[model samples]
Target chain A: MLKKYGIRKGFIAALFLNNSIDFISIFFALIEIGATPIPVNMAFRAIELDEIFSNADPHAVITEKDHLKVIMKYLSGRIVVERNGGNFLMRDSGAGGFGRGPAEVDHSIATINYTYRGYGYPLGAMVPHIQYLFGSELLQEAVRLDAGERLLVVLPMPHIFTLIGCIFLPLIYGITPVISRSRNPLRLFETVHAYQIQNILAVPELYELLYKFRDSAGDCTPLNAFLSGGSVMPDEMYGRLVDEFDVDLIHGYGLTEFTPVSRNIRGDIRPGTIGMVCDGLEYKIDPCDEFGFGEILIRTENMTKAYYRRSAESRDVFQNGWFRTGDIGRVEDGHLIFKREKKKTRKVKGNMVDLLEVQRILMEYPKMRNAIIECNDSILSAAVEIDSARNFDSEVLSIKKFLEDRIAGYKIPKIFSRI
Target chain B: MKDNKITTVDADNLRESIIKTLAVIARINEKEINDSILIKDELGIDSIMSLEIIANIEKRYNIQINEEDTMNITTVGEFIDYVIHIINKK
Candidate 1:
């Protein structure tokens, strides 16, 4: 079955897939045969996908029957979509010679997952096998997986955190991480009850939604704890999960480059802090302010050195083998308390909104002259400037409507200003 | 195009504007804000988003939306009706 498709030692395969068993199987198969699997986010629209397609030029793309058209529209390479049957997909891709014969592990690129750039282009962080070893070991111990662990997954497959926390770690730990396609809380509730899911991996945005649907799912579900990262979990939402459901809400912190740098340990929860640093990772606070708040710098064996094809940007962040996390935090009593971001980025409803990115996009609007975006109290505010002859006040709604077609909803600035 | 005088907002305009504001604030499509759809469940509008909608409503119409008016809004139609009523009084 693995006899085809010219799979070289460092073959970069872009996987445009949904959260299904097939997605997992293909990812493992790609790795088993010495091919680097790049997980492409399924939520991307044509414009965003165009940007990514240009950035990560892959050898091949493996998607599902539903997403074949979208993938084909952008990519001009060997494309494979899994049919309903298992053996069929294998025969199809293999007969096409997608696999580069016997798999051998050596010095080759492992995987490339993109990091969101608010102001700049998306960075494809290249991870090596050694980094994967450290990441897998760190996550397995941090998540506290048990032999009887049945994990529920709601996040996308392509994300670095999801790749480790949901996919790889479960495989290594000998557990099937139950993946759900729907983001609706009711569907998640059904999956949790049906599978008796004891561990769940999600982002803060979904956690907030689950908190809203707590009443309907409170008694029926069997979730022991939920491991969440990606955004700062609001203190109120955190307290509600703990107090209302008696659930262990673990807030782990790390970027797409590497994660589990720190996570709130079970039973020793801090509502606003990104828990104690994960074992095997060393963190240093480059003091930047008088209040002991500074840029969080981490040097871990598992960290990726440079962004794929982004040498300059990679050099900017990864200096002296320490990744400058652009986040401002203070260590208090063993917990890393995040103050604010040093970079012009903020979390709005759990999505990282880059102010510079927003401004750059804003400038593209026909009437837009210049703009400044700020995140105040988690509410995005944009001060837009236009040609003096045009009324900025009247263009506010139109500017926002224009943004709707371009950026995500959470990235939309709430307060519109004219300067 | 700019004016200091407050333009009279009719019921239809008020209703449309409020729904549009909710859609923008909640990050949902304007069509999703159908009259009877539960704002929280269907549109993913939480308490924070509702507050954002209220603030936007206030700012857009240049009127102070009292807490009682905001508390009464459940569905999109109800919210539009509430905003219209408040604007009429103002």
Candidate 2:
């Protein structure tokens, strides 16, 4: 079918798919065929979709039946392939042929993964196939997972952590990767017991859910370890998981540009640090302050070289063959101790929400004089300096309505206050 | 003697009230909401907002909602039915 549709080498396809077997198969198949698969977040609304589609410039869009209508709005004569169960339905809108991508991107790139680091907009990280192997190799050594063990996966499929840690790592190491369709803690517990799953790689949010539903989580004894990333884990939550559940709650720090940069070793775990830097990467803290903390710089052969179509950001991030990870941290006794993030972003529900971007979107409303967005313990609130004459209540509602379509649901502030 | 169970009219009122509450929380019009629309997916409601909705329903009805009952709920209709069931049980 790919050959029939002229999906040859260098073909870029946008994947608007759910977390299902089809997503995994299609992803690997695209890579196998030498095509670049852009895994788009399912939570994205049409507005976000439009921006990504415009930037990605995909030749074809592969989506399931549920997302076909939403994807069709931005198809613009590109090829559309709807996967229903085991069958494939391919059609061409014929408005035009395959859309041209930016000529600057390397044609041999493995995948284009979209990421946002408080950049107001997302940039596609052009990850090579070698990074997957390198990242998985590092994780395998750090976690010490045997080939026969089962690894539970419940995170969003489009996320880079899921792609490398959950999907590729398991495949490469011969471990059975159990994919959970829902984040419902009860259902996940059942999956763990059913598969006798040993380890899990999830964000802190999932671990929180497990803790919340611990009383109901029937027999999670088979679980050996819980690897956390994507966001910082609260020290209290980490303590509870370790003390209550008796699981190795390993915390790692990495970005979409490069993954498994540093991780806590399985047996020799540290409570308040991101553990030692992974092998094959050279890292340093630039211009340490009084506390011996600075912006972390990593030089790795397996890191992303460019953000697709974003030349200015690409140049800004990659300096002198070292990728400036916008994370503030210090090394104490060979462990990478995280201090704070240098970027203007907050992790809401384990997803990065750029505060400046939210403020910018809030300022788009005509009535607002200024907007200040803040996060306290992962709860986002927006205080707007609106015209005093306008009804405060109605304007608050209007701001909520304005933000609903512009950004993701999680990015929308929970509380609105007058500044 | 009086019946403890909520009548059909009472259920209708409760349903309407819940839908309106969800609409207000999701920042959408009541007319935009349908029984079949997904609470999280279509309405752009996240887990935090869902908790708010659950809290509102719990306070209004004077009942406690368990995590398991709300966790597997996919659609708005399911949520409405579950709440109505809880109210009836009360």
Candidate 3:
């Protein structure tokens, strides 16, 4: 089938699915054609959309009516397929329909992914064919996803972490993926219960929300495993899920540059650690202090060839044929402990303050579920979730006093909130 | 326009203005506002608090703030300074 579609060479194809049939058909079509299919995130904002479009520059884009205007703006001169009375490509099963030809292609640049990093860069990173193939193999091994396993692709498809880790990885093993149209917590829970989903790949945000919803609903259906990423999953929340839901959650760590770099798939789940490195990936820790934790430099078969259009930035970051994942982390007892991103760290009153550390501390409180710490020129502020029963004044005072003694005075949060 | 004119106060008044604004926001939202009140901790402001505070300061001072100016605002004092900077820029 790939030989007929002229996709023997590397080509980029996008498809919009109205139902499970469309999604499955496209999956088979792409694999048959040897073309790498890039899934556009439906939840992406305008800036994110612009980045994905500009960076990917896919040969063809298939989208629905709701996304026509945005997709058209990005794929102005490229071939566009409209689906289901929408400005998207239709799923063609016959010969010469969508992908039905072979061509010589560059094996280096096959798949492109946009990590939702606000508005800075459109395409966060690109994955070459070899890397994508290698990533699929490694992830399948790490997560123990086999042909018989039924997987749930609940995270946004546009993200490389989910696309490769969950969708493509499962597909490679011949496991069918249950794709959900919406990400609403209630709907996601219903989908899980209805589909009897054994494996799930989602962000920590989604997991936390689902955990809360499941707690209130009182219907606890057993799930084989849950995979979380995108942001740090607090140990407190992890404990809550284990204690309440009796579900073992695996934490996956990777960026757009390298998908599924490290993961905790087996037992001895450390709350904060991202787990051991995956196969075919080599990692080195350049610790700033004696503890051997400074910068995380990685080289893998799955690393991107380059960042599109940002050659200078790419050159600066990609050193000695290794991608320097701006994040600072340490390896302890065979587990990767993420400290903070180098760019986000601030020097407050002569003390190096990791804002992520502050955030983790704020979120540690039982009353606070999620917290974001933002620092400006002279002051630091924290946004925290409030327990309904706690008094705001007392909570704030305790938090302030706690930080004042533990951290530097400058690191103390001047502004506090439950918002 | 004349009636809408707000008096330009000193740095002390600017600081007080920010505190008052925060207090008013807490009262309106039925949240407890105190010196150490975590803006997102007591209420559920999220990222919108940054926008709301910026908007309130703009309305109160009749000044415009750019993205660069907004970067300095984290605490109440810095937020007041941010407003003053915008006021001076205007």
Report fnat in order of the candidates.
Answer: 0.00, 0.05, 0.00
TM-score of 2: 0.85
- Candidate 3 similarity to native, TM-score: 0.61
What tens digits encode model 1's per-residue C-alpha lDDT throughout B1-90?
Answer: 334333555666777777788778777788767788656434656445664565556556767666544554557777766766666666
Model 2 chain A is weakest, by summed lDDT over 10 consecutive residues, at: A96-105
lDDT of 2 by residue, A1-419 (tens): 76577666677888988777788898988888878899998767655676688887787888887667666777767778888875788866775335554324475478999877678777889998888889889888888889899988888889988898888988888888888865666667778888899998899877876776577567778888998998888788899988767788889988888888899998888888888899899999996899999999999888898888888989988999899888899998878988877888778878887788788788888767898989887778888898767677667666776776667778888778888
- The candidate, 1 or 2, that scores higher on DockQ is 2
Ranking by lDDT: 2, 1, 3
**Candidate 1: misplaced stretches above 4 Å?**
A1-7, A46-50, A65-73, A77-108, A117-119, A387-417, B1-90
TM-score of chain B of each: 0.77, 0.91, 0.57
Predictions ranked by DockQ, top down?
2, 1, 3
Please write out the lDDT profile of model 1 over residues A1-419, one tens digit for every residue: 42264555556677877777877877878777777777876655444566666776665677665666555565444435444533325224333434334222234457777766454446777877666667767766756778768888888787778888887788778867887866656567778888888888888777776776666574644778888988888888888877765668888788877777788877677878998887777788996677888999898766787777777888888889898888889888878988778876787765666677678778988867788888877777878778756565447656765765465556667777777
Question: Can you give the DockQ of every candidate in the order shown?
Answer: 0.04, 0.12, 0.02
Query: How high is the TM-score of chain A in each model?
Result: 0.86, 0.94, 0.70
Best by lDDT: 2
TM-score of each: 0.75, 0.85, 0.61
Q: Please give the clash total of every predicted structure, in order.
A: 9, 0, 36
Error of 1 at B19 (Å): 7.5
